[model samples]
Target: MPATADFKFTASIDDSLSGSSCWSAPSNIALVKYWGKKENQIPANPSISFTLNQCKTITGIDFQPKKNTGQFSFDFLFEGQPKESFHPKIESFFQRIFPYCPYLSHFHFSIDSQNTFPHSSGIASSASGMAALSVNLMDLERQSNPSMSEEYFWQKASFLARLGSGSACRSLKGQVVVWGEHATIQGSTDLYGVEFPDEIHSNFNHYQDTILLVDKGEKQVSSTVGHDLMHNHPYATRRFEQAHDNLKAMQNVLTTGDLEQFIQLTESEALTLHAMMMTSMPYFILMKPNTLEIINKIWSFRRETKIPLCFTLDAGANVHVLYPENDKAAVLQFIQSELVGYCQKEQYICDEIGNGALKIQR
Candidate 1:
């Protein structure tokens, strides 16, 4: 309810408690991008996103009591192999959240995580990965505090996930999610995301997002670096204002099934994301030539076919081709015949609207 952690209660550590948790969380594509941020991982402007089905991360943690120490410890793995490189990030995340979950200090953790799509290929692995991890952490908490209500459980997970990655909070739900503080949306706050209240129109619900992996390689600039650049960006204020206004319009579009306005706002947000990057002080461009080609082709295809299909980009060169489910036959055909050539190794992930994170019983 508050914008930050209320810390209303804490779990008393039980030495006999030794359990594990696993969660599968779907990646999300932002229709309204949250670019800049403030301290505590709060977004500068509210954004909306669509949770995707195919691109996901499954993370499980095995925990047991540590002997004679209250220090945080974890062995992180990626795809079943030990990954020392991922340790620092996870360690950092643990440190940020350790205060709220002091029980973490009493256990050693073995984390196993894997992704269905390429990890850093602009598919939002952080959103899925961090959300999965956050849910698992809360699941662990529920073991000691079984009386916790379901609403508080998810709110805590979304809160913790945001501390790890700002957008990760949005990955906690399905169809559509909104993160960051907003003036119009009720219950919307900067601490965690809230799902859209209005019933999403069928046309927008179950929409398709065919990821065109123009470049599978990592970006020259990480999203962290990109966000920091906004601190001194000349257009930061204007961009933030635009995002707020766009989010308002987007709400109406989703509720009323205004596909034309949807396409316009989505594509504009995508291009604006890159435009910010290109205009940064130490300017850098993330969109490759093939990214441009795909964009142009998508525009031409839409013009020629009059389909409601449109494209959006993350911080990388990859393109997410979004359209209504009814248009999938034509859209997929267009991708197979025209857009596949631009992808690295013709690699693309077919994804659609999805329900948020799932807890694995095992």
Candidate 2:
């Protein structure tokens, strides 16, 4: 079911000429990965993710009505410097979502965005960045009409975020979020994601993600290219079926806090996501030598200590080590003593399931 709450507009931009909004949104690590996508950024299969804390993007947008009759224009900055590469993607996002915010084309947008973690380094930066932008757009809507319901506000933000980046919809809120329509989950739709309503044990609430950056370079194959390759993938049908089964099983695991099943399913999903890439029409491999080494060590460590520590990977070479809060000390000791060697310059980010996006005043 859609969430309902009051939206307190504590601050707003100047109403006469211009308005501005700022938001900080966290990136998410998918347990049931969203690999292939359809037209309009729809997911090929349902996926669930944990919204992470430390890794996030802060975005602020200043909007002003156009002085002349012309197409929408905007300037983008990443950490206060011109980012020409981001303009086309943002332009495409605006073009795709023009209907939802028709007034957008009539205004000029000044967007400034910055990330807490490295871009294209295995973490879902696009998810955080786009979701933050989506929230700001929603705030703009609220500025014009204060009567918008809270449920209506977030749903529209989630919907718009999905258009910018498919996985972004899941970055909205709740520790766990589900994207894509499912027969078993009610109120779940392809247009937007909804929170997982089942009982999540307290033990899993403080789950930590210790990321090991095996390679800091850009991915060999972009996620956009990889998603398109799925159209001609040999195992496309079976892959989708596997994802559906995994999602259903994960729901049970989450509710019961079955760490054993959680490790099995999550590891398999991570490997399967990369497997699809290797089998694509123009096959490509993203994992480096250290990436595999880290995975093997994680397995060995789990067997030696029986600490319930496991690993998963995003689209890049970085590895995300997931474990419960109860084992925080042991896990940190393990990472410092063992896993840190695999990371480039010993670089890694410690994160946890976060509370989604935040509105920044100013």
On lDDT, the candidate that comes out on top is: 1
Query: Root-mean-square deviation of each candidate, in angstroms?
Result: 1.2, 3.7
Worst 10 residues of 1 by lDDT: 2-11
**lDDT, candidates in the order shown:** 0.88, 0.87
Best candidate according to TM-score:
1
Model 1, range 1-362, lDDT digits (tens) per residue?
75455743466779767888899988888999988899989898899999888788999999998885557788998999999988888989988988788888888889999998876666658888899999999988888889988878888898999999888998887568899778878788888888877788888767899998888777789999999999999999999999999999999999899999999999999999999999999899999999999999999999999999999999899999999888999999999999899998898988999989998777
Model 1 residue runs over 4 Å out of place are 119-122
**What TM-score would every model get versus the actual structure?**
0.97, 0.94
Per-residue error at 55 for model 1, in Å? 0.8
lDDT of 1: 0.88
Residues 1-362, candidate 2, lDDT per residue (tens digit)? 44222222333334355778899998999999989999889889999999898899999999887765357789999999999999999999988777677667667889999999976566668899889999998888787768887877788888889989988998888789999887777678888888897879776987999999889887888999999999989999999999999999999999999999999999999999999999999999999999999999999999999999888888889999999998999999989998889999898888888879899998
Checking candidate 1 for backbone clashes, the offending pairs are none
